[model samples]
Target: MTTQAADAAGSDKLDSGVLKVAGVVVLGAIMSILDITVVSVALPTFQRDFNATYATVAWTMTAYTLALATVIPITGWAADRFGTKRLYLLSLTLFVGGSVLCSVAWDIGPLIVFRALQGLGGGMLMPLGMTIMTRAAGPDRVGRVMAVLGVPMLLGPIGGPILGGWLIEAAGWHWIFLINLPIGVIAFVLSLRILPKDKPQPSESFDFLGMLLLSPGLALFLYGVSSVPGEGTVAAGKVLIPALIGLALLVSFVLHALRKEHALIDLGLFKNRNLTISTTTLSLFTVAFMGAMLLLPSYFLQVRGETTLHAGLLIAPQGLGAMLTMPMAGRLTDRIGPGKLVLPGIVLIALGMSAFTQVTADSSYVLLLGALFVSGLGMGMTMMPIMSAALASLTHQQVARGSTMMNIIQQTAGSIGTAVMSVILTNQVLNSPEATAYSAVTQGQVPASQVAPAVLDQGQSSLADAFGHTYTIAVVLLALCLIPAFFLPRKRIEKAPDATDEALPVAVGMH
Candidate 1:
């Protein structure tokens, strides 16, 4: 073979190797994300199966989310102290083990505990997967790598419900947890073979005080936010007290971090313009998108009278649109930068959100599908590029901390969105004239389904109006996100190569 041909072949081999590493990370991430969303569709079934009250069953989700928030703050430190590969393997094991335990759980209490155990491992996977991929792909190709990695983010929410609904119908709820085993095993084995081995940074000091302050603080804050949906108001004592205590602890941690040189997560990274703007925009985008997503399934199930499987399938168009647009967006982001893409993406999202505000009880299915598709396209163009821009602004040493910070913000913002939207929807439904009349007739016992036909009709109309109002609030939130989107950097940044050698270590065995 000619020398140039041989060079081309070698380059192809190197590219292929990078893809294998990214694929493994993406697979593990999908399992982690899918677990949270898939289980959501089974919540009602859990109450039935365990013969438990709504509040007790609800703790299944609450425990998982709280554990996730508590553990996420410590991931960067853990990754640095232990090697990233070892940490990744250990996390995957814990998550899979938790899944196994959950499948065989005999009671609600054990189920909640096992779910929290799952969260312990699941929380670390996202940030660490991103960190691993960013390091392997290097700065020059980070955008494309992120695009590939973003597939799971796009698919998880849309696919989870569909998969969960099917499992419940065909194999029972146990299969939801059981499904993780093969996927986890495959990812674990591939990672052991292909992932580069890094030496642990033993010289790094553990940040005990920071962990104490930040972990519980974040967990409490998330707990407060999660309470809003159940309490139906921010003014409720359950909401206010935990939120205030969390705020105080977070404030103390911020002050401590500002003073210390070796904090758990470096707050100083916010000084980078690109990083700051990208993080802010990403958080806002998540709030808007997640709020709308929360409304979609409930709307279908309650208003349209769709089964969980059908409702989940209805949500798939958005994922389809995102899948179509993301690869192109990733390429454009690498060439022209994130701001150019984000502005148009935000506009499309606004247009899609606006369409939902017009929804009625008998609105066109085609129109809803189209709007969801457009919104997904917008997400594809916006989210990954914004994340890429943030990582591009940081030095290699900061990537781990930066990933952790981004995930925390994203999770927190999503919680806030869910809470705010749920409260708004609940209030609107209760205040509607039809609901007020129907409530008086039924005395808040069982739903109007057992009452007269007219009562059922009135309740349905009230719910439609309530959902419409909730969507309008979502549109407004999406519009507000435009302010941050405009501030994103318009040109690709050239980040310093401080830790690239350590990041992309020599591939040892695979040919």
Candidate 2:
């Protein structure tokens, strides 16, 4: 044990034991992250199988996201209250059980309910995983470990649609949920055997008041935001009423949190300037980047008449580009500071996305792919470094709470970005003279080539214009991210003196 501790303390490289724990965390993360995108591609399949409208089927996604938002505010407290190892196992159990139930759901309503149940578990996985890894890696190596954990974040979007599309086409929609059974079981078992036993501090009182306010507030606000794309206007009653109520509750929570030491999310963490700037930067980057990412597959399917699988394949270059830069950026972040890497990354992203603002119906595939690859390269440098900068400066005790806050900001920002962009594109398409033909192409009701040539030409042009205009907004948002990135710490972060090196047991019996 002394030898193991000495080895861990002496080395900067990740030893085998830490890598094993990372593997466990990554597996759980894959299951949680992949579920979101996997289910998205299966939505149309749900509509067909359950004989439901698109709006009704969309609740499957909305319900899952709402459950995620609702459960997230409580996770930091829960991890400390319940041992992380035990809670992690329970989450895996719930998620897998929900997956099983979803596979057998008989109606759209049942599926939506089951998906929310799944999300209740999924919401905790990433943040919990972050806490575990942060502890295991210690503050000095957080940048590298965070980069390792970022694998699924990059892979899920690229792989989910392809996997989901293939499953839906070859087997059935049920397999999409059923797929989690094997992965979940393996993750559960590995977690039990590999992870360090939890050291829970249950002394802090649970913040029930904060929970009541923030959880419902986030769910309601996001619910209203999610409604915008479908309703086509934020002024609609359904959008306005719930959003206003949610805003009121959120404001109340903020005021209430300010007075309390142990609020649900610990709003006081914003006192850390690094965390504040990083949070702002993450919010803007996710809104612009993720929102734009969602639109790419849609573009290929609608304008280019590609299969879901093909669209997913086409988007792979961006992920591949990210893959190229993530590891190098991680190492550099540990040696330097995030601000240096992040500024250049944002610039590259803006440059890559600039091409999309000029997209035409027959834009060169090579050119588009090159642009996406460049954007991916920028992503590799940007996302996790910001995360590392935020958490590295926090005390070991505060890592869980800090990660929770970051996750909440990310979820809310991403939802808003998706909703806002969708509305813009939807409006642009609807207002076009070729609205009917373009709508048919987008909805998969008709192929662009099959339409009258003149109409196809004009309609495709109109559709491209809408997408181009939307990309312009996304680029502007990316530029806004640069303002915050410029402020991130540029020097190597020092470890907090209190961050003791408690090396994890290499195996179940070794300690």
Candidate 2 lDDT over 1-511, as tens digits, reads 4576457667777777778888999999989998999999988788888989889999999999999999888888888888678888998998999999999999999999999999999998999899888878777788988999889999898899989999989999999999999999999988988888777875489889999999999999999999998899999989999999999999999999999988888888899888999999999999998899878887888777788899899999999999999998888898898999999999999999999999988999999999999999999999999999999888877888998888999999999999989999999998886855866866867886877878877888889889999999999999999898989999997765666665233212212
Clashes of each: 0, 0
Tell me the lDDT of candidate 2: 0.88
- What candidate 2 gets wrong by more than 4 Å, as runs, is 441-451, 502-511
**lDDT of candidates 1 onward, in order:** 0.84, 0.88
Each candidate structure's TM-score, on Cα atoms with residue i matched to residue i, is: 0.94, 0.97
Per residue, candidate 1 scores C-alpha lDDT tens digits across 154-264 of: 879888999999999999999999999999999899989888776666637888999999999999888888888788788889989999899888999999999989898
For this target, which candidate reaches the highest TM-score against the unseen true structure?
A: 2
Off by over 4 Å in 1: 1-14, 433-449, 497-502, 506-511
Q: Residue 254: error of model 2 in Å?
A: 0.8
